[model samples]
Target chain A: MLHIVNKSPLERPSLDACLRIAGPGTVLLIEDAVYAAARGSAAAPRLAEAMQRLKVCVLLPDAEARAIADRLIDGVTTVDYAGFVDLVAGHPNCQSWL
Target chain B: MTEGIAKKFMFVNRSAPYGTVYALESLEVVLISAAFDQDVSLVFVDDGVWQLKKGQQTKGIETKNFSPTYRALEGYDVEKLYVERESLEARGLDEGDLLVDVTVLSSGELGRLMDEQDVVLSF
Candidate 1:
């Protein structure tokens, strides 16, 4: 399954919920959720731990839009919308954590 | 409708309108999605139920009232709208209080329906 989270971790529990249920699947951060991928944000440590188990990525456009492209944590891959479409197609199902 | 494949797409609305841009932006995606001719459905749960409440007054907020645009969804061939029964009841809302007609389903049934979708987008 592909877990897509679009809510800010600072404002909502969607990222926490997604991390709890995401097994070996991919977690793609989009919209405001991209903030969680930043280097010194509140979600960085948890995201680092999650990266050890599964692929953790952030939408490149979203990160760039927020001017955090240079601040993304190490090992978090960045993907474009076409890559997002590919991830969706490759996964059996997708759960959007709002 | 297109003569090719159509994937099942479900847009889950879980927030109230106007408070945030999610509800409005989600509606924008739904409207644009009609061009793809996909099998699209919408599910309203949690505060999302408030989006359908009738006589929404945005004058106090100075925002354009977009709730009425929901009634135009059918003309775009996007007609599958579901509201969670438990959510409505929990919020002290009834079917009669909603602005649009919808098929109300139990949370369990809605979960099953969600599992059947190929794509699920939440807002």
Candidate 2:
């Protein structure tokens, strides 16, 4: 399964719920949720810990748009829109953390 | 309308009811999805657990009280409802507080259940 989050961790509990509830799946951060990929942010450690159980990916354009492209944590894979579509297709199904 | 291809669908609700449109919209979507004959389950976590709290008085708020519809889900054969124990405890609510009966599971158990589903929808 693919877990997609679009809200910032600071503003909403969407990412927190996804991180806590999702199993061994791919977590693709989009929209404001790309902030979770940033190093030293409040959502970083938990996201990094989840990496042991799930794959972590960030939407490059979203991250770049927020100007946090260089601040992302290690082992976080960046994907474009095509990659996003492929990730969705590759997984049996996905849950968008709204 | 494919009669025999039922998918396991788990709808994850994590927002407070009535504060925003999410809870109501999710309920509407769930009802529509049931027509497809999918194996549907509803999971309430975080503030979403509040959606099932009994005695919702929306008369003063002027919002149509939609909590009653949850009781009607079983009629649609969408009887699978699960709530996170941690969430319930945090909110000081128990099974008796909810309008419907639901299987309460630990967050860990809930994650495993989520992994088994063919589709997960979050609201």
Candidate 3:
């Protein structure tokens, strides 16, 4: 399954909830959720652990918008909207952890 | 709703009480769900922890102080409240600083509780 989350972990717990509730799957972080991928952020350590079980990806444009594109946690893949579509197509189903 | 069987409904509050409308909106729904006699559970995480802090003075911000409403939740029979330990500690807050009683649990523990719920609402 593909799990999508779009809230900042600093201001909200959507990312944390998603990481906990979701099984092994693709986690696509968009909007403010991109902040969780930034290195040195409090949420980064948890996000890094989540990578061991899931293929974590962040929307590049979103990260760039936040200016954290350069400091993403080591293993998180950067994707554009095109990559986003392919992920949805690849997964049997998805949950928008909105 | 269903005649007699009460479904477990968890309301996951993730927003602060002020600066946005989400926190207040979430509380209003919790009240209605109680009226329907559903089993209600409230979980606070991240900035949502601020909602339960003691002695909030919203007068300076001109926003209606609503943190006290959480204290009133028990009168509505909404007793099950949980706060994420990590979120609380990260914010430099503890149970004693809160206005009401709550069980602090880890994310893993909360996830198990969420899995048992029939419905989960997030704000």
Candidate 4:
């Protein structure tokens, strides 16, 4: 399954909840959730840990929209909307963690 | 409806309108997605029930009233709109208060319907 999270970790527990149940699959961060992938942010360490166990990715357009693309933490892959569609096609199902 | 590839897409709306852009933006995606010809269904749960409320006046907030646009969805062939009964009752709203026609379902039924979807997008 692909877990898509679009809320900022600072504002909501969506990211934490998503990480708790997300096992060995892909985690695509979009909208405000991309902040979790930024280096030195509160969610960076948790994201770093998640990266070791899952395929952690951030939507490039969203990250760029928030101007955090240049500050993304290590081990986080970036993809565009086409990649978003591809991820949906590749995964059996998707759970959007709002 | 793509030839031999019509996937079930369920959009879960859990946020209220106006306070955040999620509700309006989700509607935009829903409208654009109609061209994909996929089986699209919308589930209004939690605070999302507010999006369907009638008599919304956005003039005070200086924002465009997007609620009216929802009525045009049926013209785009995007119809399956569902509202969680518990959510509506908890919010003190009833089916009659909604601006658009929708099927009211219990959360359990909504969950089963969600389980059947190939894609679930929440906003």
> In terms of TM-score, which candidate is strongest?
2
**Candidate 3 segments whose C-alpha is farther than 4 A from its true place:** A1-3, A8-17, A20-48, A54-98
Relative to the unseen true structure, what is the C-alpha lDDT of residue A7 in candidate 2, on a scale of 0 to 100?
93
Between candidates 2 and 4, the DockQ winner:
2
Output the number of the DockQ-best candidate: 2
- What docking grade applies to model 1? incorrect
Docking class of 2: medium
Give one digit per residue, the lDDT tens place, for model 1 in B1-123.
Answer: 568889999998978999899999999999988889999999888788999999999998999899998898999999999998877997999999999889998765776676677888876
Model 1 whole-model lDDT (C-alpha atoms)? 0.87
What is the C-alpha lDDT profile of model 4 across A1-98, one tens digit per residue? 68899889999867875675455579999999999999999999998988887899899999998999999999999999999999989988888877
Docking class of 3: incorrect
Model 4: runs farther than 4 Å from truth?
A1-91
Q: How close to the true structure is residue B80 of candidate 3, measured as C-alpha lDDT?
A: 100
Worst 10 residues of 2 chain B by lDDT: B114-123
Per-residue lDDT of candidate 2, residues A1-98 (tens digit): 79899999999888888887777889999999999889899999999999998999999999999999999999999999999999999998788888
